[model samples]
Target: MTCRVVQWATGNIGTHALRAVVRHPDLALAGVYVYAEDKAGQDAGALCGLSPTGVTTTRDVDEIVALGADCVLYMPRLCDLDVVCRLLSSGANVVTTCGEFHHPASMAAEVRDRVVAACAEGGTSVHSTGSSPGFISEALPLVLSSTQRRLDTLTVDEFADLSYRDSPELLFDLMGFGRSSTDLAGRVAHAQAGFGPSLRLVADALGVPLDALRSHGEFATARDTTEIAAGTLRSGTVAAQRITVEGVRADRVLLRFRATWYCTTDLTPAWDVRDTGWQVTVEGDAPLDIAIRFPVPLDTIASVTPGYTANRAVNAVPVVCAAPPGIRTTVDLPQIVAALG
Candidate 1:
């Protein structure tokens, strides 16, 4: 049976998800949810740079919900809890990359309970996935560890050049890009929200329960003002920031994920940004290190295979929709295979 899908937004990742939804053989694009007034009246196909699909975009939440889509590719600018809750209660399974409880297991008890209640009330499901806090940290590491009989430490790092990202507000304000290094709480909070679940996924996979989990954040300051695509980096302001989630077992770091993002020509105590987009190291049995690089071809809207994230969430829709209601994680689903040929 073909699963009906609604594209929730047309943002960086959403744009890719929209295209994938239209192409997936097992999925049908029933509706397109637009948040921006300018995008509301356009055709869904036009928004994704495709031929007319007869799926006109609309900002009306009621309209999309009324479409009775079986699954929602719920990517908005950010997580909108009210919207998510309402959708779950409306009997629609949700799969999002919006950094909203990607791992429902990591959410607070109260919030988790509410999601559970919504799922029970509607008999639906919700899942969250992404590229960084997602497969790299959770899925890939566990897959690599299958060969290792003994495992000690696992580290996943992502050094991204956000210059390719177009969201100025996201790159600057939300990320504290030009903010004072003295105050990095905002940036740290942003990373923790996403990384927490991925860390949990790793610990669960290894059958190791962490005694304590901690968030670590640090930043480097710019010696001189510099300009980048996202925004400007002023002297003395933050030029680079690192966010880490460490899962501890008996005082040793068993698993950890770190994301370092910067946008300057001069980095203090300089370190070269690894040209590889991602790196995963396993200091166990045979000691392994792996790096990944995606050839993000130059385009008007620069992105690093945003399709990777789109496919991550889209491929999980079937499993999430089939699962019992509540917060589902990577642990709840099997290996996701792409339906796009």
Candidate 2:
């Protein structure tokens, strides 16, 4: 059963997904959706550095809907509800990297209702997944918890060394690196909204429904001027930041996720930091400490990081497409078995 797939958004992650789809034995490149006019009319293969696949890319949503693909790999940087609803309502099962749809119950009532209605109308399903909130925060914890009958606290620590990432706009302008500490209310809220859903989903899966979700952020300033791939980090500027999201139940935190992102190691207040990877520590009857590291060198992280996100999404297509019509979470679907042939 070859599943027809549409590759949406040819960005970093999407590009990797496109290449994977073209190579997968059980998947066919039915269509390609691009956001830039320059990418339009180009062969999908060319966009992802493969031979011509005969499927041309398009900037039109209507064209994509008309293709009636079995599944759409939606990897846009930012998600659009309208586009998602339209794709769902058009009968295309969606597998996305968007963090919001990871846990449907965590979504706002109106947004959830709209998506539910769309799924009902088209008789399709949508799933949200990615490397961080999806694989690390949700999937890995669920797997580790199976070893314990009496579980206490589960913490997932994510560390990313962005010193070699060359995206200036992303590091400096967007993430607020190399800047003085200002009001972090917005950043805190963003972290809560981004990671809270995954935490809630994990809690619910563990039968420990959270009473509330709490989030906070902390930052360390640089001790001296440093040069990074993104830009310059001046002395006494924000160099490292950590955001923690907790799932609280019965006045205790049952699940916790902390993301520590840093551009430089030299900071006024030294903090424990690691390479780009994740550490999962479980405290229970069968306590475990596990570390998953990206062994790639810092210079090539940009080239290799997308696969961590895109490949999981691509592997999930078959399961998501076969799922019952609704929003499917990591808990709802069976283990994703990649058809690597």
Candidate 3:
């Protein structure tokens, strides 16, 4: 059976997800969902630079869901609880890109309960997935735990270049720091804060309460001047930031996660890390160190490859959409890993 999908946002993430649906044999583009004001009347294909797939974009979730779309992939710009609730309660399965859904701590009590209840009431399933929040944050740890031993600890580190990323807002506005750094104190706040929730995700996946988890973070800026071929800006800019999250039970750290995003120049061997490489250390009598690097072509937005980030979310849709409705986490769904052909 083909799954009809409604894309909620048309931004980089949404567009990529849409493209994935268009290419997938198991999924079909039913309709596109945009914010009330942003590109409401445009064809979904035009906005994403794809050929018309007979899917028109609209701002109406109720009407769209009623159109026989089996699932809605939400990519709201902000954590809009109302729209998410509507999708869940309408008996349409949902997958979102909002950071809040990826990390429940980002949601308030009322909104969280509302989403959970909506899913239950509508017999619909709701889930969120992305690069960090989805696979690396949740799936990787879950994969490691398969070894089956007296669990000691797990650590996941991410090294990325902000300039290389399609969205600069994640590093600038959200992190709350300029591109350059002048103050020696390293005082600028982070914009694309990733580590905190990443650690928490690992904890949640491991079924450990955060009561004993300890979080610590440190930010750093480029000491020397740096500039990317794509953008303007000289020295004294915020270069990079590092954050670590350690989950502990009974004063012993059980999980440790470190995430670092940097400018291209500040990134040593930037090309290598950008592709995908991780160090997994297991502590036991013998101890073990494992490195996993997923390789694909380096070009961004490849026509044939779709988008890796989008695939991470889209590949999970089957399990999420088919599951019993409710606000579910990665643990709630079948293991969805990004595979290469």
Q: Which has the greatest lDDT? A: 2
The CA-based lDDT of model 1 is what? 0.80
TM-score of 3: 0.79
lDDT string, candidate 3, 21-48, tens digits:
8878788888888875768877778887
Cα lDDT, model 2, residue 168: 89
Clashing pairs in 1: none
- Residue 94 of model 2 has an lDDT of 98
Clashes of each: 0, 0, 15
Each prediction's TM-score versus the true structure: 0.88, 0.96, 0.79
Per-residue error at 52 for model 1, in Å? Answer: 0.9
Candidate 1 vs. true structure, TM-score: 0.88
RMSD of every prediction: 2.8, 1.4, 4.6
| lDDT per residue as tens, model 2, 1-341 | 89999999999999999999999999999999999999999999899999999999999889999999999999898899999999999999999998879898888999999999999999999999988879988888999999999888999998999999899898888888888974567878987888899989988888889999998989999999999998889999989999898989999988999989999888779998988899999999999999999999999888999999999999999999999999999999999988976
lDDT of each: 0.80, 0.92, 0.66
Worst 10 residues of 3 by lDDT: 183-192
Which residue window of length 10 is worst by lDDT in model 2? Answer: 178-187
